[model samples]
Target: MPAESRTAFSFNNSINPSTFILIGIPGLEEIHIWISIPLCSMYILTLVGNCTILFIITTEQSFHKPMYLFLSMLSIIDLIASTSTMPKILCLFWFNSREINFDACLVQMFFIHSFSIMESTVLLAMAFDRYIAICNPLRYTSILTNPRIAKIGMIAIIRGSVLMTPCPFLIKRLSYCGTNVISHTYCEHMAIVKIACTDTTINRAYGLFVALVVIGLDVLFITLSYFMIVRTVLSLSSKEARVKAFGTCGSHICVILISYVPALFSFFTHRFGQNVAPQVHIILANIYLFIPPMVNPIVYGVKTKEICHRVLRIFYQKH
Candidate 1:
């Protein structure tokens, strides 16, 4: 490859900061305009949707149960997750399309990862809630009472924040001698860490470990929760009870699958499938981050009839 191409390729590894303006994907710069419009619209809608969910669950007497409480927590996480990156991303498509300072980049990466970890943990909690409701209905109230639920939610948020703090701090310590252009829309941990001038052995290893610990543990717990849920549902005496239980969990399962499957695909592909097409990477990247927020409210509203009716009532009242 020519020197320019080589420079672009090695930008991630170089520690010396040469002043060069970062530009996004070629032939797709104009496309970002269109992308931004929809993204901004979606971000607004996500905020509104999630906020509505939270308000409904909090204020409604009917939604005082454990299930809606968990749903409210999930909505809060989704709102934060989407907010962490989408605003910066949309800004990049507009006036602030140039250099992102190293410090700002690190900040973005930290929140993005932190919120993602929180989202996963919240999903795991949701799974456990489902398991309790289905398998031990008599004790579901006692098991996931307000105090216990609040404690678990706090633990999830704190764990995610503490675990992801090191990633940005590690990235900050590394030298950036080369080009600073990040390939993707956001300052992702791996994408940013890969550019360090020093030996990123520790960073990469720690990142891999964090990814496995967070994603793996969440997946495992979610799977186990569902396994128990399925067993309980199957053992139910009436088909109606089984259907109701499954129906209650359907939105959660859909949201979980949508959020995690793409993430796993991106994770593995980034490691082992480097040679894959940039388009594939871009598509998966967008889907992994963006789609979940867009669909979360839809899933909840569709699968949970009460939330749906409440959301509709809110809309009607607004107009």
Candidate 2:
């Protein structure tokens, strides 16, 4: 085929070229207006919910516990992750097909991955906290003291940020000789890397490696922590101790499942199930990215009684 014909064929094969396209479910445009309303509401709720969690944690003296510290870190990650993607999506829906520069896209991708990794790490840390609290309650205070918790939080942030730094740099090295249109809504690493005109073997390998490292390590550590926790709970002399331990870890587990399962689905879909409908893909993508933030505050508030009261107090005081 002639070069011009080849170019034309590639262009025709892809959905949109000028900008990233949001592949929604078939006939979704009919309900796009309605969908937009709820999605916008959720976006705002996610922001407020996470921000409120952060505020309460910062302001409330009683919430300075190790578990709440991890919750606060999760809230910060959720805030950054949700803000990194949603505002631009809302702009695209409301104003125009927003165009992101290459550098900006890279930056967005970096933060998205960074925050995601951090959330996962923070959850692992939370599991460790629960493990310490339940498995060795006698030393919980000594082991997870304020200064120690602060150190762990700092380590989580540093590790997550450093791990994701290579992603943007790797993406930058990839040549974009062809059209720059990204599929899906956000600057996701897989979606953007797919458009590289150069060989993307390294990109794919790196992505898979990073996913395995972050998700795999997190799941492993959490499972180990919970295993120890369960063993400890079972051996407890009183039923009350078991109940308390379970209660303390329940919210963290809920948040972990909410965040990790969707992420795994999206990762697998992008990696193995590319032929799926665009709308299905987009919906899963959005859920994978957004739901954690929206539900995080609720999980913490409902499960952790102190945070709930603190959040309510803040609202009541403001009014």
Q: What TM-score would each prediction reach against the true structure?
A: 0.90, 0.88
In model 1, which runs have C-alpha deviations exceeding 4 angstroms? 1-22, 317-319
lDDT of 2: 0.78
Candidate 2, 136-197: lDDT as tens digits: 77998999988888888888789878888888778777665565656566788888888777
Give the count of colliding residue pairs in each prediction.
Answer: 7, 2
| Residue 166 alpha-carbon offset, candidate 1, angstroms | 1.0
Give the CA lDDT, 0 to 100, for residue 145 in model 1: 86
RMSD of each: 3.4, 4.3
* Model 2, position 202: C-alpha lDDT score: 86
65-120 per-residue lDDT for model 1 (tens digits): 87787778878878877887787777778864656666677777787778788888
